[model samples]
Target: MSSARTTPGASHHEDAVGTAADGSGLLTYASLVDGKNVPSDQWVYVVDSDALLQDAFSSLTLKRKLESGRLSPEELPGGSIVGRVARADRETVLQAVEAASRATVEWNAFPLDERLDRFGALLHRRLTEQADRTIEILLREGHPLALARWQVSGALECFSPESLAFYRSQMLHESRHGERRISVRRRPDGVVCLNPPQNAPLSSALLGVTSLMAGNSLVVRAPRSAPLGVMYVLHEIVAPVLEELGAPGGTLNVVCGDPAPMLSAWLDSPLVDDIMYFGSSEAGIRFQERCVAAGKKPILELAGNDTVVVWKDADLEYAAEALTESFYGSGQLCMIPNQVLVHPDVVDRLTALLAEKAADVRGGSVRQEDVLLTPVLRNEKFFACLEDALSSGAELVCGGHAIQDDGTRDTAGIFLEPTVVLVRGLEGARKVQAVRHETFFPLLPVIAAEPAPDAVLLDRFVDFVNSNPYGLRNSVWAGDPEVVEHFVTRITQGGLLKVNDSHIGFLPGLPTHGGTGLTGGVYGEANYPVLRTSHIQGVSISDGGIRPREAVFGAWQAMRGEDGTAAAGA
Candidate 1:
């Protein structure tokens, strides 16, 4: 369903509205609001369910429909909806953002409890009722089922009081000099914008949650590729709560079209205080450069080349199980393992074990499942590296097939099979290192080594993975305690560290979301989402009378409440 946002009140434009689904067949193209199939007549913009909720339903037409509680059956779209978002020029975005900037005063006046309670309800419903649709829409929009579900569902956990209460920790007052001592407090940055990628479109667009919960207005840059999930997830979920919670209207806005104009506008304007970007390291750096030039703070989570190492004392079964994490989603996850380093003693044994269990390592279209992997449709560049490895004498122990020339959605279901290439010796090892680059397909390059020859081989391998420029998640399968301790201490590299388990084990609330190095600027962790988006306000409160007080205490005499342990001197 398409909802018109611009108006002197809502009016209709009838110009033989025709739309196509990303150049795909027309029959499959459906819009959610009106439930109308995109007319096979002319080309138009297509949005998935989530975007329907965010941009469409939340638009003037659908918002009135939902508010009036009279969604017409004739207007209900069939598959999904394709709507028109007039590709606005920079002035449009600036105007809308300035309008929101003016609205922040009233938006910030709402009590935190009431506001959170509203979003909290929406968050709960998101997890409980609409989660399945959220999953289906994400998968339909071209993301792995498990990965998509986790991306959408996991972020839902942020709705509860416990989830965002930490945001208010420093915002509240503490006791000190008989004046209800308020140490530090944080305020919204007025307006914050988010531009998210298409891979996890549903989850990424919600990066606006940072601004929303922090009392700042959020204007999201929704990816045009799969705008459905982002919109619908918001309308069917967040909108109702935001309304009931009494958030000022226009505080949460969405612009659904080419992000180029919108992003450029946001960067050039003084209205936007922060810009959160999620995508390639290259794009992020360039965007950040622009933001810096325009004097705006940009929070980015970019590309990662994670690694997984199997030790001599590792469990073959467990290491094999981790193949799901490294190879699944075609290794598109930022935290997914990019390289698998094997110790010499377990090299042959583990390869054989993997070959036997390789049936579990499968790939197909996003619509299909039990299908553990996806063909790396964009893997031609990586192939040159693979071919160079082969020419340099790397042996192909497993898969080598590439997707066919004319790959349709149906044909693209299965791309390259899970490949295992073993480099000749330590001489060719550099050719297969993830430390150098990343490959987003199910082609695993195994770097073989004989840990039996030296006691430090395992330690050295761990160090190599840790010392790499990328710092996502890296797993090591081993049963040795001393080795675990050594790694746990020395490996301060990846955001998530795994021992004797899969890289996706601590997922959902896991700290594997962000990394540093060429990967991005600031390291990221999911649990620290709120803090990452807001500026810190540290206030030191004492009973007062500094001039009368002769000396200052060197240590804090208090401890954090229910946050686990005490600060060093507390």
Candidate 2:
């Protein structure tokens, strides 16, 4: 909880939130687990001569710190542990940053493959060496083991050979017409602000590292809710790799606490080129708007209310497994299926199987195989929202009960049984609802449609999922080759779509990240993680090159030129 600080700059009073920090300045919140050692988050504003000047200085200081490795250390509330970084004085950050700018140039020029290999090695080592401890921190931090596994394992896979394969697939190109050979490089912006969710720590670091390996500097502004967990993963596992790999010091900077101001600062600063964020769509959208206003590229893995379309041809048991994964993290992920599109023919059968499976899923304390991350249920807020939707006519099929089990009803012990709500057709109060928009909490609403082999239902479902305001992930549980094909063709066009598979099964190097349009600026699966980080520069040395189409006219545009050769465009 200690750091050197000089004269601080602009500051502003914090806005009121639910929880408050203790006298020791420790952050305290009503987390999924109460009485835990997790710190309460603190918010501060950079003070300046004027409000606009504060923003201007905040942006300036953010850039200097990002360029230099001299990050302001964040301390947890109570001063027992460090939670978020403190903002250093403007002069101090600027002076420290001056040294790091040189490293970015060198890091960027090194061959991409060589740098990727270095990170790939880091992933390998982190997996083998830090496996046990990594798992422990994630569990203690509130993520269920099942969810933690994805976070840790996803990092390993992100820089693995598979990811390399995906990058290869994306980076190469074949010429279509006349000597215009091309390749698309997923360039890294100078520095990226990756704000990961509390539910995922390792996955967030992997997101930043994958982009860094793609040749960009990075600054991770982790969520204040569980910043320490992510900080551990980054500082312990990823940062060591960057050091060993000869990457610039600021290749990836880590910070926790309120991200709004840092995000605003980064967006407004020239040193930071991109912002990678993960959270509710509303928050992500706000970040995107600010980034756009600042002319920064944003890669938002925003909210999702994904739907799994199950056809009568599908194996009910397999579809059930997929359903389990969709809600594995208590349906907090953007990829988790928020609803099910069950054909009427198999509704009764699949419904029965799902109910049985749901009943059997182990509950209570988070265990190794624990698939569910019991949400910090909103209680009265949850029920009130449910009632509003139900009274508006959405059917409550089963299990909306709060934990009536005396064994598990504490202030911080938030748990909700897997929910199953049924909505008829596409509209009514159920249609175009929040349930239809994004995955939040562990609620699954099934939209049952008339039985038919026609792919029309799935097509309509795809449109509904993709056309909605936000885009991240969508999936299908059908075995029909035709359905699978359609799902692959249509869904992959978005972020990471799966077929007869779990919605959250993301492999390294695969474009299993980033989304389109409403989600954020041009980024997805973080697929653009590497591609978007670097800018494109075309180079050609033709062994035998240059051939242009001679127009119908004898002289043509080329001959008309003074040099008897047309400009490339001409």
Candidate 3:
């Protein structure tokens, strides 16, 4: 391990720091294979998300380096650098797979209770203890503070007592019968490989830890662009817990590299039994086909075009607040509301409130506590979506421009304004691409259905929401029990359904992630990684006195009378 030094103004927990040749601080990380920090000859740097916004000199120097070919665009992600991560090669990926395959033997043998204690209970406690440091690393890696905190909170919720208990029940259950014992249990799927998405890699990686509770060894590919936080959680937090539990050295392997080779390696490797993939739905569906062809279970967490329906009876203020969640992380997150179906009666009021709230969501340096807008590296899609909606006869409610890091409007700005468009009628809304597809940007479309009887409108709203191609989450807001019930029981979409609550907030016993349809491929649903990475087996043990003939015919024989004849009813 390289020695770490604390730079001036840095927190004490910032131990990933190393001094550069000029004596300035640089955050450093390495890939972990077989419980070792494997450094590489090639390195890639991740710029602080706020570096360009906050430091003119650093920004100018980065620009000069880029122009001079001293720093290639591929080497510096997000435009400038605060940290350098080892870039793993094909060999490192193979090493990780080999280590994970070897460790799975012992890991799968450990009792489920012990695995949960180490991976669920103890890991949760350590994450809480290091919460601040974790959040700091997330911030440095470019996550807005609020989104980062929510990610950590959601990840921790997976290991809560309630969640762990639920997992335990799902994993195993035993029952007693006269002279017989019946056990239903889930067996580890052996080596499970995780390909976490780059947008929220650390939390996604942390969530992947639940596979450990199922006694499956892990090979996680940290996003090369944002590898530090993911590496910190795995090596700094998760590894220690595994060590204390006496897990094999190779139980958890992490590598940072180009995703194509790593994914191909996993798909082709015989030792890999399950692959937890996260990406766009189009690509994920194709990957799912590949995984199936390779005889590996594919657990996909894909794109979400989630919907939020607001009835006229809803508390407009609260519903509006929930709608504002669509703009969280500038709407880059998969779980946020992508489009809304509002009762025409309440559409105007709700949209007004949403625009008012969205205006408060400002773009600035990630270091700012109040900032939620991060740099939208490629906003061409955002513009294209916005234009498609408008051209399809949708009216712009508010926000259709780009904002600079300083929160000023400029075409060249890196941050997109929180945009909301009003699409009239269900049919017309479908014509808008932003409403039908995952915009993956701060572009929300509020569709106001044509006015009709309450029953007719309610049915339309439910049907519209259910017809959505992508389904990660769906939320409804209504004060009436009937309306809420109608939505709850009738809407057959999404992995989770929220009612009159924060759309993206985490709750115990509820899935922090996962979805149906495009959001999750054919095998996708509310994903509990522990359960996803394991398979169930039914076990029945009989007493020595029981004969095989008796076991097979006893139940049927009981229906017969004592005279060796069938009973009256039989």
Per-residue accuracy of model 1 over 9-71 as CA lDDT, tens digit each: 122223111222333222122221111111222122444433332334343355245224475
What is candidate 2's TM-score against the reference?
0.75
RMSD of 3: 3.8
Candidate ordering by lDDT (highest first): 3, 1, 2
Estimated TM-score per prediction?
0.76, 0.75, 0.93
Error of 1 at 112 (Å): 4.3
- Report the alpha-carbon TM-score of model 1 versus the true structure: 0.76
For residue 404, give model 3's deviation from the true position in Å.
Answer: 2.0
Cα RMSD of all models vs. native, in order, equals: 9.4, 11.1, 3.8
The C-alpha stretches of model 1 lying farther than 4 A from their native spots are: 1-44, 47-91, 109-118, 157-182, 365-367, 375-379, 403-414, 424-428, 433-435, 450-455, 505-509, 522-527, 540-570
lDDT tens readout by residue for model 2, 1-570: 221111111111132111123332322222111101122222322211122122334443543453244433232112222223333332322222332344567777878666776566666777668776676656645566776777767766766777666665664443443444555455545655577766664576666666666666666655655554555565556656666666666555555545566555566566666777776666777777777888878777766656677876888898887787655665666667677777777877887777767654444444447445454445555565566557656677655655522224344445556666666666452453546566476667777775555767777666666655555666677777887787677764356676776667766555556766555444544355777566665444444555434423435754567566675665
lDDT of candidate model 1 versus the reference? 0.59
Better of 1 and 3 by TM-score: 3
Q: Model 2, stretches more than 4 Å misplaced? A: 1-100, 168-187, 367-371, 375-377, 404-413, 427-434, 451-459, 490-493, 521-526, 542-570
Q: For residues 1-570, could you state the per-residue lDDT of candidate 3 as single tens digits?
A: 334322111223345544233333566656778877787766666666667566646765774574355865455544356766667899989999999999998988888878985568888898899888888888878888888888888978878888888888899899987888999999899999999998999989988889988999999998876788887788778887888788887889888888888899999999899999999999999999999999999999999998998888899999998888888888888999988888889888998999999999987866677888877767888998889989899999999999887668999888889999999898667878998798889999999999899988878888888888888899999999977898899998889999999999998878878888898999878989988898989998986888898779887777996678998989
Please give the lDDT score for candidate 2: 0.57
Return the lDDT, model 2, position 517.
57
lDDT accuracy of residue 345 in candidate 3 = 90
